[model samples]
Target: MSLFRKITETVSKGVSTATEKAQQTVEVTRLHSQISGKRREIEKLYVSMGEAVFRGYLDKDLSRAETKVIPACEEIVAIRGEVEALEERIMQLRNEKECVCGRKVPYDTRFCPSCGHPFPEPAIPAAEDPLEEFDRQETEPSGLSSADPFVEPPGYKDPGEAPSASDWADVGKPVLEEVPSAWSDAGQATPSFLDDADAVGAERADSAKCPGCGTAVGTTAKFCPSCGTPQQ
Candidate 1:
């Protein structure tokens, strides 16, 4: 589509050039017409002079004839030459211009070979938005306000959603220690025997708790290790 538009723009430019050439054509035509009228006027004068001599009014002067008529003829010829030059310019412009049909499209054309679509119009760049420019100016390397380590991005957590304290320590301090047994109400995740048939399964899960902190840790954890507090 963009390609077609560009071709249309090319054609428009060609048309404008042709319009200028047309003005030249009109000027040339007008000049030629004036020159032709002058030539005819000189010929009439010659005829009148000949008639007067035939009637015995006076003798025909060859020198006078040359002086009066030759310059007019020469001027006519010069005007014709200008007309021819203008004609040639018109033809050249036509050949260089884009055709309405696509079949004879030039090699540089971007539009369709048969249909003229997606023609490009002259581009008028959009004016820059004042607010946008101002916003951009505000966001340079020194734009951000100085913030404390605890300060987070505006949407660090969803609105009204409480953040887990435990997760914060893990993320904030990469080397966080685990909770000790002294920190837990029980030494481990207590079993619920009231669930009856699942008692053994629950006990297995409970036993996997860290012995020192009673916090859940992997079965391979040798001792409670997250926090500086010692294991039970």
Candidate 2:
């Protein structure tokens, strides 16, 4: 009974190992095929580029041809190197697994008892970009009027001016009213002319006539008596 149990355990272990190996083989083959297809695509592109160059050469457009072909040539060469390295690494991995020719094995190989090939070191992928990913920072909202070019920003702080009692009082009034010009605010204060008209008449009675045009002071006429110059 014990012997039978031993045999059963051994057989089960063998079956599991065989299944895992089969799966590994399939996955490795798929990997190689995919890589090979990519390599072929790159090769095709290279051929197309060569053909374009050849066409330009035939047409005698050398400079235009160079410009077109150079980038494609560079890409092709870069791809070729990558593909070669990948293939060599795969071959090395298979060899290290004691794998038969074209036979696949698990990647975590220990030793190749058949050919004595060491395990392939994992390839570090080169940082490559076909599409550029730009990370843009979001702008903070600014509360300026969109329609006006000279609109102040929302955060605009007045340079100075802690409002005193006077400034607060002036906010509701017209800007023109706040101005202290003598001509505009003259009505607010009494002018000297009407208040002292009697005194001035007694002092300068002869000077009432216009010096420029000899205009009379009270003729019921705005123009001068002699030359028609108006009393300004």
Candidate 3:
């Protein structure tokens, strides 16, 4: 073959190889994507199957699948262990005591400041180093310069504590007068206005006088019975 023809042929072969490699790469990537999608679908199917099995048989106690239940229980135990490990790590990092609400508190804390729930004092080991304990207490949580802002400090007073003399400023202060009872009266402990009304009516009837002629009027008279004058 001529030199020019050889060079042209070599270039064509190289171009074809490059194109083939590119096509292979594209095919490989497409296959990988399909495999990933299939894996996700399989995972979802497994979850659905577990849900169905548990709901139909194991949960209802009709039958148990040791194959499924045992594995699930093992996973749960593993997960719980991991969670406890993580919590211990967090507690160590934060140098805080755990509250019932999963909130961090101080070692010396008597109660959860947030929830007001009392804390159980942990038993101390005799061989424990005082320096380490002090350092642990001194170490603050990440992102905090000092103790957790939500936690009350040493010697802090809770709002629920019994009121002191200073708190009694408003205690002895005059309260609003209570409403009078229905039966309250000067004669009784609390006389009603109806009683006074009856007395007033009796007085007016006994001393009934005419407005125009000053004549004495009967209790049921519309006008003076003596002078025939109208009673006001």
- Candidate 3: C-alpha lDDT: 0.63
Poorly placed runs, candidate 1 (over 4 Å): 57-232
Which candidate do you rate higher for TM-score, 1 or 3?
3
lDDT of 3 at 61: 62
lDDT of each: 0.54, 0.61, 0.63
Q: Give the alpha carbon lDDT tens digit for every residue of 143-204 in model 1.
A: 45567355687748766788787657767556655433322244665444435648767767
Weakest ten-residue segment in model 3 by summed lDDT = 177-186
The best candidate in terms of TM-score? 2
* TM-score for predicted model 1 compared with the true structure: 0.25
Candidate 3 segments whose C-alpha is farther than 4 A from its true place: 1-64, 122-232
Model 2, residue pairs in steric clash: none
Stretches of candidate 2 exceeding 4 Å from the true structure: 92-232
TM-score of each: 0.25, 0.38, 0.28
Residue 219 lDDT in candidate 2: 33
Give a tens-digit lDDT track for model 3, residues 1-232. Answer: 2435555897999999999778766665655565556556556656855875777674776355555655666665655565566556545544577868776765655555455566665697679888998898778555765554687789788888987887677876777755535542345554457789998888776776768666555455554434445455
